[model samples]
Target: MKAAREARSAAVVINAGSRRGAASTELAVDAMRRAGVPVRSVHPVKSGTELFQTLRRVVADGHDLVVVGGGDGTMTSAAGLLAGTDIMLGVLPLGTANDFARTLEIPGGLTEACAVIADGKVVDVDLGWANGEPFLNVASVGLSVGVTEALSPRLKRRIGSLAYGIATMQAYARHKPFRARLEFPEGDHEPMELEDVLQVAVGNGRHYGGGNIVSPMAGIDDHTLDIYAILAAPLREHVKIARLLKDGSFIEHDRVYHLATRRVRLVTEPPLSVNLDGEIAAVTPADFSVQRNAVHVIVPQSSNSASFEGPSRH
Candidate 1:
């Protein structure tokens, strides 16, 4: 226990703007201290830009581990700073969706999450890149981008993950079909084009959009990104596809196109907004690639989604 406690020194950063952070911050800090993990600092950040800067400072100050408490977007913002370094990233999952946390099998509760960090099992995982930014879950355009743009913070705090569904419905009503071309750029695959594409989601991990599984077999350690593109079809057909997606069987649908590749470039007619792990990452005419084993994360030993490789010492 003493060896594990001394394995990595940690600093905690809680995004105070997250829905549950205010309620869970004290509890999380207490749980970590009780489990004997040495916490060097605690920071409460108000925005993604602030969180990113704070994370860089924490790493620079010699802390080898950073326990970030927020939703997927906040965590992904930190990944841009922590990627390729030897720092061990720890998650607290105090957000509305926590989609990336679901991918990691990190517990939703503060106590269990803090306990996982205390256990100190580290594993290297793949990262999805969209126009040079690193993301742990999905990078998407079309309908999901509209959803991110329409989703309000008040609604999110009131209804949590259901806020995504509400915003999605509204986005769908206003969504327009657009031409999309997908190219391998680096992988061994031919280019593909679609006439009317409603949405394109490239997933590095299994889940996105508040628990929707973009690909059933996708994993952060798999070294590939799974692409799910929703082709424009009749409303009835879309309803059927939506049912399959809700059932976690969207892969079997015909109108949905799936690809697993090392790198991809997407060109859309008239440029669209792209959401990465729930935040607006970039605009369309974008490039994406997989950074295999780019970041190390702390997870529980029992987590099937991520296997424990060993301890990380920087």
Candidate 2:
């Protein structure tokens, strides 16, 4: 244990709407108390608005750390408060996917995750912004926005991560290619246009849409956003690339464009919904940027030594 250096006094907020919220919160509270953190308050919020209001109160009350229990959506809602602030954020993955938690190498086990928070190895990590809105994991448009719209809570509970894959297929069938231009103003790259764009995902962390790897070498601490664009292709070609993506080797696929940059902008002919983390947060034309080392997060010691794959230029 590293002596709970960054988080001595803390407050916890659990999203009552989360699938595992109630059960996970009880276990997390007991674990936190055992880990020597004096939990100043514990709140169960029914909506993102309530969760953020509670978090603001917690920060005002002098709590140094805020432990949040929910899925990626809940995290994204509260990200505005935590990112670029002195307050440290601790996550308890109690929602579907929990993609950001996966990126941090945080265990899903309640007791194990608590131990990581208790041991307290805090480090800085990047935050992704979509149209001025902050997100912890990834933000996307096109197929993903459709997937988010169609995703049912019942399906998520029954099939877990597979639900995303199923929804992807369903969304893809109804999806029409949209024309979009991507500009990397900060990186000084030429604006690129795609006549047949299916989906564009910008990842602040490595994993998104469950456990799928956005970029093999992407890391939260790397200060760069990983961009993955899946263009319109034949069903057969899509199938082949899906296989490669499953193996974290999709970069070689021509239809799949990959870029690593600090900032970029996506402009569509007609504005499209942008799914940030897991919820539809904003709409394009959206500006995506990275706030380097903007958040302090607790993680296991081994995570500090974890290696992330970098962009592989083809």
Best by TM-score: 1
Would you estimate the TM-scores of all the predictions?
A: 0.94, 0.93
* Candidate 1 lDDT score at position 222: 86
lDDT of 1 by residue, 1-314 (tens): 11234445789999999999877778888899999778879998888778888988998988878889999888887777777777788889998989888888889998999998888577777778889877888898898888998799899999988888789889999999998999997757889988789898888887777777877678888888889789888899888887777445786788888988988999999698888888886888889988766777887777778664433221
Model 2: residues >4 Å from true position, as ranges? 1-3, 305-314
Reference-based lDDT, residue 211, model 2: 79
Candidate 2 colliding pairs: 217-308, 217-309, 217-310
Give all candidate RMSDs, comma-separated: 2.5, 4.2
Residue-level lDDT of model 2, residues 56-169, one tens digit each, is: 888788778889888888877666677667677787888889988888888987788888888857667677888789887889989889999778988887777778888988
* Residue 4, candidate 2: C-alpha displacement in angstroms: 3.0
